[model samples]
Target: MTTSTGKGSIVVVTGASTGIGASTARALSRHGFHVLAGVRRAGDGDTLRANGIEPVILDITEPTQVQALAARIAADPRPLHALVNNAGIQVNGPVETLPMAQWRRVFDVNLFGHVAITQTLLPALLRSEGRVINISSIGGKLAMPTYGAYAGAKFALEAVSDALRREVSPLGVEVVVIQPGGVRTQMAARGVATANHLAAQMTSDQETRYGGLVQAVNSLMDSGTASGVTSELAARVIVKAVMTPRPRTRYTVGRDAALLIRLARVLPDRALDHLSARSLRSHHPRTPTVGVLSRLRVGVSS
Candidate 1:
């Protein structure tokens, strides 16, 4: 698992408590990087350490933690080789009825958090000739009904990634975006809950127009929850992008990610939206399997 770059290279990965972040931490460790696995909770950090990783307390949404990470890495003499910004959350519902609070919550973590952490660590990255890997989603490229908040934030992230790549490439820093279609994670559960929460907050007429849509979205999340990519597989992709001599700017994962993105681009917005609605409806369950799918979606991956 060692690389020619040397085992002492320093790597910083955010949201290492679960899903892609946790998997990336372990994968990078196997590659011999001294990983500073960042997690919001101390208990989660302890779990990472138990698995042979060095855990650091970090919440990307917190300014102090982000600054501390920068300070600590800058003070250390070891070259900072990579930064994996993998922390994210999902919120789903009609944009019109979506609570402003929920919208802000999603963006705060998915967009602003990534930017804050990256900006804070940019100096170290420049000094080490390192790369920044943003763990975005297929939603960043395609818009679907009921995922307005989540998709909006990811869209912003992709734009920011594009800008950062241009801004930092001259400084010997690289920016890579990983756009995964569907990897089973807590994200789906959060999206579903957001749907219900938003529904409750809506007016009767608004709910009538969109309640079925939200339920359909939850159903689609359930049906699509089938065996997908594992976080380990995603981590492998990140490791390749980070360790490769000439990394690609964008990497798309999952079976349908590429096809869907292509379709979304070629098809008219209304057509694509209708298609997504149909797909959502087809996945909603009429039986007990619905419950299973919902639970499975909370942590399953592509």
Candidate 2:
């Protein structure tokens, strides 16, 4: 860990190699924060350094790397002002057929890894009265078919954030959740790849059982990606969560995110189900009859 004579409030942004995390690190640096951008690869570190942000080699899911990050920050003369847990992976597949390993991997990165980092950094954060900002997704609130693994992780993250907020508020450390609807990021591409790979791996019987539903869900995901907001927009929201005098407990970043949140809160379960099914139907009109029927069944069961 190299120490630098940097200026202003200090922040650590995990998964700063690309997408929202990278944008947030850059934005925070521009806003006068001495940003420590966490990356998993050496090349990514070079990229961040070239852009004038300090880079820390960190893979959040790796316990030793996470510990090294905490130790380095502790040793630094500058007080840590914020910790942003933005590192996450997406696993898109049917819930019934999704591998347990993939589910564990998603939760490890999205929820457990963040918890470990937060716990490790609490001392520094408490001393600085800093903030912990979690990057979640609109899927955190609304779960769609084939997005169960990612959404499940985010949902758990939200619950963890709420609990951490209540527990740490008295200590002057704030915990916030930023849920972005659909940000134009590498994550969407990764999700598409994951979905495609999973679809390819399915046996004939599994395909017959889950193929239409997966297609419907993938179509919905494509729609979200098409209308996604910019990563910089999400970064701005993150900066607000960190810099605001009295930070909000949660913020929905994109306009689409805000709308989805509103609908999730106001609409009854059946209404949401019907709307979701209809949207899926619009995409895969012919083959996804099973998808619609399954959705209706789930709605009725609920």
Each candidate: RMSD:
5.3, 6.4
The lowest-lDDT stretch of 10 consecutive residues in candidate 2 is 1-10
Kindly give the stretch of ten consecutive residues in candidate 1 with the minimal lDDT sum: 288-297
Candidate 2 overall lDDT versus native: 0.84
**Highest-TM-score candidate:** 2
Backbone clash pairs in model 1 (N, Cα, C under 3 Å; residues 3+ apart or in different chains), count: 5
Q: What are the per-residue Cα lDDT tens digits for candidate 1 across 1-302?
A: 21345377888999899888898899888878889999888999888884337788998998998888888887788888989999888778788877788889999999999999988888788877889999888899987788788889999999999999999898888899998877776667666775665566566567556666667777777555455577788888888888987789999878777788788779888888788767876655455333443443444432
TM-score of each: 0.89, 0.90
Model 2 TM-score on a 0 to 1 scale: 0.90
Give me the displacement of residue 178 in model 1, in angstroms: 0.2
What tens-digit string does per-residue lDDT give for candidate 2 at 1-302?
A: 11122255689999999999999999888877788899999999887784448999998888999889888887788889889999999889888788899889988998899999998988899998888999998989998878788999999999999999999899898899999998888888788768766676665667778777777777777788879988898998998887886888999988988998899999999998998888887666485444444554455456
lDDT of 1 at 258: 75
